[model samples]
Target: MDTETLSDHLVELAYGPKELYVDNTYRRILDSRYTEIVGFDFFCALDDAIETALIDWWLSDDAFWGEVKAFEHWQDEVEDGMAWELMDVWETWYGADGHVKIRKASEREKVSYDKAMKKLLCEHEKKKVSIEAEAVRIGL
Candidate 1:
């Protein structure tokens, strides 16, 4: 497989849902005689090598950990007080028709609502950026 495809597959095997099962499958594939017969030890080694590199990267990347911390902080903020209420309102509006009274809120109420929504959105975006950065740092 091409390097990008191999890397993508390794990332999925390492980080995807049901990771333990995927890992076991990866190991089994590596140990298969068919792999040896086809001279694919190098390909198998790529996965092992990438896993080691990812571990090393994770251990050495302080910036990645900082991003993780920032993400967690925003995540906590998003779950608290006004931010939490704004998120709930957004979810309610998104998933269903918002209540008529809420939809018809007064201008002053709308301003407060808008401000809270904006704050929540900003925090959410910040959290997402950090998460994507972490993913990139891991070559995922």
Candidate 2:
């Protein structure tokens, strides 16, 4: 395949939605824990610093914990983890919102890491070019 097509494929794979299970149901959510230092094209289209900041705020331990606490406080049975129906009806409560928040935060976080990712992509491209040049020089 051509270089650009390969790059696009790699980026799509890297930034694609992930499958996650909550309450025995599968959902597609973007990964948000840490930046994977790949796919600069996706990052270049975003505002990295601001995106990162928002992701940090939304996905922070305190923020998540606070949401959980809110749910628990709002519903006493949450402590026992007995009532998952409340989460299924997230529009009426905090459960689905929590998941959606995390997904958005993860997407923003990926954008935030774009600058560094661009550099990594550049270095990788440089190596690929260098190797190609060496092979050409040797009449490969």
Candidate 3:
């Protein structure tokens, strides 16, 4: 799927804001390597808009896809030694899930992954603070 094809499909798609978010992600995925939705054969054949739409319908009611932005955040703490990786992933995450309810990836699996990553990030942040406090108290 090229940019022109994605734009055309977006224009024709009958998606609400939420669905549009999913569609937007799907568009990027189409532009990526895994053009097909794995199980489907013709749903990713470059010009098969209908096929793409069909796959979209199949994934219309995902609960996990809604957690992308809510769970992922940009932690821009210069002291944390993050020059770019954190920023880069976060920026990409925002661009993909920002203006659209764009759907891509499997909701079943991705929701869990996103949730776990968020949880771990929070825990790591808390640990960092606790370690700093300990160091300060010990005059180290």
Candidate 4:
């Protein structure tokens, strides 16, 4: 399928599908690809594109057309790294069932998280630790 068509289907899946269509599509897409480097690269690229689009859509207040333009304001722009960080924060502060009942974190919790992040980041910077190492250290 063309990129636009595939993107549309992905966006539909992202907006809460009736079934696990994305999982089914993932298996099908992987199965259809050839067992070669080029095929592997294509699959990875497509997978990244799908994941990025889904994250963008979920993060946006309105994800029409699967574009990230909604977040590209003059004062703020959600770049890829920032998007990943936001996702990480969401996953950390809010558990898997967070959507069922949205609960704001307490001030103490926020302070604790901020202190932990600051300490971890300082350690990383001081020791020149790789991000992967830091992520491992924090159980990410």
Candidate 5:
């Protein structure tokens, strides 16, 4: 099938059952050349596309903020807990010598982590825009 037709079908499947989407894609689009070019099976591609679309939809719709907010809250808690645990281990394992090492390591990690988080958010925003544009382009 053509890209436009496949995209249209995917958009339609986005509004329906995931299993049906996977099954349909597998039966209609899963072939040797397609798999070789895509580097994955039909279900994996469909799943990723559906997930991206769902995330974009959720972020665009105001009502889904509750789930997103909860996820952010959980991430914050986990980050705080990890920091505490690292400090606790550093103090317990090597009292004075580990202090400098821990500080340096923490500083390095903080910089790297900040960069990674920033990059991830930027990528996500870009992906959201791309998905939205693709949907609009296909007149979905």
Candidate 6:
């Protein structure tokens, strides 16, 4: 395979999403967390920091495999400890929309370090911060 195709395959295996229109906030969190955990540098698309994070994780050192394993362990603990409470949080905060709920719930599940979440990011301190930023930039 060509270099570009090989690169695509590697990225898909490590961080392919079923859809692209995910909440950008969740993308930022996932991308940033993987960068802090994976311990390596990889080429991310220009300004596509989230894609960069995924590529970095996919191409990182052997420690990255261990990091993924740790995430799995964390996910299990979260589900086992607070299944219903989390589900209710989803229903209330997200809404009844199926797609929104699924993506939000996925975000909640994949979140291991809530301390480093988008909620506390240097730039995106609040969801409304991002929402308003988008609104103003795009004049929505």
TM-scores of the models, in the order given: 0.36, 0.24, 0.25, 0.24, 0.30, 0.23
3 or 5, which is superior by TM-score? 5
Model 4 misplacement above 4 A: 1-90, 96-102, 127-140
lDDT per residue (tens digit) for residues 18-61 in model 6: 23333232333345346332211222232256556555654454
Off by over 4 Å in 3: 1-105
TM-score of model number 5? 0.30
Q: How far does residue 114 in candidate 4 sit from its true spot (Å)?
A: 0.9
Identify the candidate with maximal lDDT: 1
Candidate 2 local Cα displacement, residue 2, angstroms: 25
Residue pairs that clash (backbone atoms under 3 angstroms), model 5? none
* lDDT of every predicted structure (CA atoms): 0.58, 0.43, 0.47, 0.50, 0.55, 0.46
Worst 10 residues of 2 by lDDT: 18-27
| Best-fitting candidate, scored by TM-score | 1
Candidate 1 structure, TM-score to reference: 0.36
Q: How accurate is candidate 6 locally (lDDT)?
A: 0.46
As a whole number from 0 to 100, the lDDT of residue 42 in candidate 4 is 52
Ranking by lDDT: 1, 5, 4, 3, 6, 2
Off by over 4 Å in 1: 1-40, 81-83, 86-140
- Shift in Å, residue 127, candidate 3: 0.6
Model 1, global lDDT: 0.58
